[model samples]
Each structure stands twice: as C-alpha cells, then as structure tokens.
Target: MAAEMSLVSVVLFIATGALVFFLLFLFAKRQIMRFALRSARKPHINIGADAPRELREEIQRRLTIVQSVRFEPTLLSEQVLEASKSVPNHYLHRMKALDAFTNAVDCLRSKDTTIGLRGTKQTMQLYLFTLCPSAANSSQAQIIDMFCSSYNHARHHPANFGNAELTNYMELLDKVIRMIKDNKKRRAAALYPAVETEVRLRRDCGKRESAETVRHTGKSNNLRLQARRNQPAASRPEHVEQFNMVDKSSGYSSTDHSSSGRGSVERLISPQHSFKPERDEAV
Candidate 1:
C-alpha cells in the first residue's frame, strides 16, 4: 500500500511541474507578442541633431537675404507702413504668397482626416499653379494635381498606402528638394563670371603647358638627328703600292732588300735609262 501511494505522489508531482512550465511558457509568449505589436506601431524617429558643418554653412550662405533696406526689430513693423512707398508691392506679394503656401502645407499635416486631405490637395495644387501657370494648362500643374488626387484617394483607402508607401513618398519628396537645391546652386554658379573666368584660365594654362611640352619634344628629336648627321665615319687603313724585287746577292735579307729597294731602284734607273734599250741600260 505504501509503495502504491509513493507512485501516485510521484505522478502528481510530475503533473504539477509540467503545468507550471506550460504557464510560464504562455506568459513569455504573450510578452513577446506584445513587444512585436508595440514595435510595429512605433513611428520612425530620426536620431542625432548634429549635421555636417559644411552643409550647415552652405545652407546659411544660400538662404542669406539680399536686401537694400535696413530696419530695427522694434519699430520695423510700424516703419514698414511708412516704408511701403519705397518697397515694391510685388516683393510684398511674393512674401505673402510664400507665407500662405508654408501655412497651407503645415495645416495639411493636422490630425483631422477630412481637413488634412483637403488642405494637402489644395496646397499641392496651389504650389503647382504658382510654379507653372499657363493659360492653356501647365504640365507641372497637371502633374501635381494628379498626385494630389492620388494622395486623397490613397488616404481614404488606407490599404493603398501601408507603412512602406508613406516611407517611399517621404523619400521621394526629400530627393525632389535636394535636386531643387542642387539646381539652384548650379544656376548661381552659372551667374558668376569671375568663377567662370578662373576656370577658363586654369584650362588655358594646362593647354599652354601641353603645347610647350610638345614643342620641346620636337626640338629634342631634331637636335638628336642633327648630332647623328655631324658624326664622322670609321677610319680605314692607308693603301700602299707593292713592288717585287729579286735579289741576286744572298747577303741581304728580305726586310733589308725591301727597305733598300727604293734607294737601289732610284740609283740604278736614271732619267737617261728610261729612253735607252735594256742592253744599253745594262751596259
């Protein structure tokens, strides 16, 4: 009986341990799922406020206002009324237009769905129209209008724009702004004649150097050719006449005979012997 009771106790202990493990596993799984859901709902935040110093300086330089009129902050607002005579109306109109556009874009990002969509579409259309206004109908305006319509449709149908879609749109907008700034920089560069002149001078100097190098190379080749022509040819041995003289007296050696031959011939053959016969010459 005691053995049977021990066995039953062992089975109960095992069952309790398994139940505890299963409960812990369930709790862990729930925590993991909650973390995943929270991560999915979180908005992406751009980190780090420090931008490259060069980029900041470039932005400041480009945005520097070019104004002939100076006014104090305290009295500027009131002075503006009096200064209206000097200030161009067109300039004021442009400022007001830019302000309106900025405000419209900000309003489009509001929490109210209907107002946000309507404001966004209207702001987009306004920006397009201002950029390109045509009596016939501007292509830029038409494109913006189409994009606005599509955005409105997408907003109403949430499935049309998931997280990826919104991310892509933001990326595209960033690229467009970057391209616009680049184009503005290029246009500014084009307007500066001093910069262009410096570039031209640098190019001209490079070309001049290349021409001088070519001229020097040609001169060197000509000098080398002239030097080759002025050089002398190899010297050859001098030619000497050979004469065969047989010696009747064996007392003289060949070297002695060779050396004495000229003197002996000169003594034996006189100017008179040339006109006389061989026997007379012998006598």
Candidate 2:
C-alpha cells in the first residue's frame, strides 16, 4: 500500500508538469502571433487631403503671408539662360531698382487704396525690380517710358494715398530718372568723343567673358561671314538680306533696312557664328 501511494504521487507530479508545459507553449505561441501582427501592420499617416478644411485654409494663409514678405525674388525662375551666360547672382539685386519699373501701371493704379494699400503701393513701387534687365535687353528705356505713361494716368485719374504714397512715388520716379541719366552720362563720358544719351542704357550686364573666348569669337565670325559670302546669292532672300554689306552688289538687291535688321539677327543665330564646313552640318 505504501509503494502504491508513492507511485500515485510520482504519476500526479508528471501530469502536473505536462499541463504546465502545455500552458507555457500556448502563451509563447500567442506572444509570437501578436509580434508578427504588429510587424505586418502599416504605419499611421495623416495626409493633407484628409485634414479638416479649417486647418488647410490656415496653412494656405500662412503661405501667402510668407510670399508677401518675400525678401528676395525666390518665386521667379532661376533665369537659367542668364546663368549659362556667366551672369552673377549679385546682378539680381538690381532688379529691385527696376521693380517699380516693371509694375509701374499697377503701382500708379492701386486697385484698393483703403485696404492694405501701403503694402500694395510699396510692393508695386519696385514690383518688377526683381527682374533687372540684362545689358543686352535694350528695352530698359521702353520700360521707363511705360512708367512715365502710368505717371500721366495717375496725374489725370488721381487718387489719394494719405501717407503721401503718391508724393513719394513722384519723388522716387524723379530720383530714378536723375540716377539713370547721371550714371549713363558718366559712362558715356569715359569713351572717345563722349556718347549719346539715347544709346546709353544703364543696364547691369555681367562681366566680360574670358579673353580666349573673345579672340576665338572674332576669328570665328570673320571665317563664318567669309563662308556666307560664298553661298549661292539668291538661294534665300533672307540670307541675301543678311549680307546687305556684301550681297547688295550681287543678285539680291532690296532697300529694306527693317527686314535686314531683324532677318540678319535670325540668320546670325541660326549659324551660331560657327557653321560647319560640310553640307551635312548645314542640313
């Protein structure tokens, strides 16, 4: 009876151990599945499209305020063409001087003078200043002419900018006129026989290209023109016009300086001052 009782105790201990082992296995399995699910789950994301309307509008208002406070012309394109021509970023500052010039009409014609008008007018005073024309852009004078026209309009259709905005504008215009005239005249004075006020445009063109480029450019131009002199005279009237200096005595004779001036530019560019010597390159 003692032996049987001892054997029963041993059997009961084994059964309890097995049950504990089974429970531990189930717990481990449950933990592993939870970990896997967490690993597979996508991360939570909150996109603007899913945002409330009020939040979106507040965000947009902040953007507008930031843009209005543009300390620089960051909104404009980087002007890759100018950059490629070795123009400097420093030249961009001159655009501020031209700002009022570009937006002369809008500055003179403040649409809503009663609300945010000072900011509007001040902004307009130099509106186009951010796009300072290159020296090659001969139309800088034309822009000033536009400003003068706007000034006339303001004179006739007068509105009050109580803080002397109009008065300030006139003063600024006078200053700009004097500054441009003085600077151009000073530049002209340095050259032989002085120079004409009409031809001197006080534009902020960048530094000169390297001397090698200038020398090669001259040689290339002479060679190219000599080649153009060789093409059959009347193959194209435009080409004939280009060589007015050389083709006038030839078959293509027409007294139209206007067509020659414009067409000559097109022809020159199309050739790049370096036309290939072969017919294939021309083709």
Best by TM-score: 1
Query: What's the TM-score of each model vs. the native?
Result: 0.21, 0.18
- Taking the tens digit of each residue's C-alpha lDDT, what string does model 2 give over 1-283? 9999999999999999999999999999999988877887543442355779999888667866874563423222336324624853432222322333333323323432211223433533232221122211233433443444444444333442222333333333533333333333322332224222322233345754433211111111123223433546464233122212233122211223453333221222222221121222232
What is the Cα-based lDDT of residue 249 in candidate 2?
21
Supply candidate 1's per-residue lDDT for 131: 23
lDDT over C-alpha atoms for residue 48 of model 1: 24
Taking every candidate in turn, the Cα RMSD to the unseen true structure, in Å, is 48.7, 28.7
lDDT of 1 by residue, 247-277 (tens): 2232223223354423222222233221111
Which candidate gets the maximum lDDT versus the true structure? 2
Candidate lDDT values, in order: 0.36, 0.37
Which residue runs does candidate 1 get wrong by more than 4 Å?
Answer: 1-6, 29-33, 40-97, 100-118, 121-283
Question: How big is the positional error of residue 47 in model 1, measured in Å on the Cα after superposition?
Answer: 30
